[model samples]
Target chain A: MKARVHVMLKDGVLDPQGEAVRHALGTLGFDGVEGVRQGKVIELDLATEDAAAAEAEVREMCEKLLANTVIEKYDIEIG
Target chain B: MKARVHVMLKDGVLDPQGEAVRHALGTLGFDGVEGVRQGKVIELDLATEDAAAAEAEVREMCEKLLANTVIEKYDIEIG
Candidate 1:
């Protein structure tokens, strides 16, 4: 099975790295870029064949380690 | 318009960060965690209402700034 997780900062959270990217884009002549939010993608190749099990396991992984649940949110996709 | 870009290392590329994450997960008792790859997701808010134009502009940004065209590949989604 394959699992993909997207970890993104929650609304109302300050994202300095995202701000830096936005500033860099402005300097690179992409002035129309209004806002930028940067996140992470984690792809996992699992041995399990069960889609439901894969999703549940990956969700646990996200809650335990992949994400800072307080300031960030994560979405999981299993295939 | 909104644009989401996913930047990932190409196959056969060495990803020390991903390896480290995998190792950490193993130590945290998630032994079934096998191959893990990490990437970046960049979300942009643009001024243009045209989805095609927004995608084109964001593609340019990815090619020129957001992604290293050498060892990384980027996919852009516009809305």
Candidate 2:
């Protein structure tokens, strides 16, 4: 199974990386560009047969290493 | 309105950041976790009323700034 995890900064959290990108875009002449918040993406190729178990494992992966739960939340998609 | 942009590395591309996180998670006792691909998250508290135009702007943002289009792709959601 394959899964994609998108972990993003929560509302009201500061994102300096995204801000930098937004500014860079403005410099690059992308006039419509506004704001950007940068986060992490995790793609997993698992050998497990259980999607439920994989979700749990991935959640633990986020909590422990992939995300700073203090300021970010994650969404998971499995295929 | 707010929009969320998730940019992820395409399959076959190297994601050293995610691999590092996955290794760290394993070290931290997340045993079942397998692979990880790190990406960028952009959160926009857009002031625009047009979701379609905003989506276009964000797509440009991703192409020009938030993601390295050479190896990454993005998805945008507006609310």
lDDT of each: 0.92, 0.76
Off by over 4 Å in 2: A26-35, B29-31
Over A1-79, each residue of candidate 2 has an lDDT whose tens digit, in order, gives 7878888789798888878877777788765545666776677877687889878877776787677899988888877
Query: After best superposition, candidate 1 residue A38: deviation in angstroms?
Result: 0.3
Q: What digit string (tens of lDDT, one per residue) describes model 1 on residues B3-69?
A: 9999999999999889988998899888887799999999999999999889889988998899998
TM-score of 2: 0.75
In model 1, what are the clashing residue pairs, if there are any?
none
RMSD of each: 0.9, 2.8
Q: Give the Å error, residue B47, model 2.
A: 3.0
lDDT of 2 at B40: 66
Tell me the tens digit of each residue's lDDT in model 2 across B1-79. Answer: 6788877788898878878877877788766656767776677766677989888877776776777888888888988
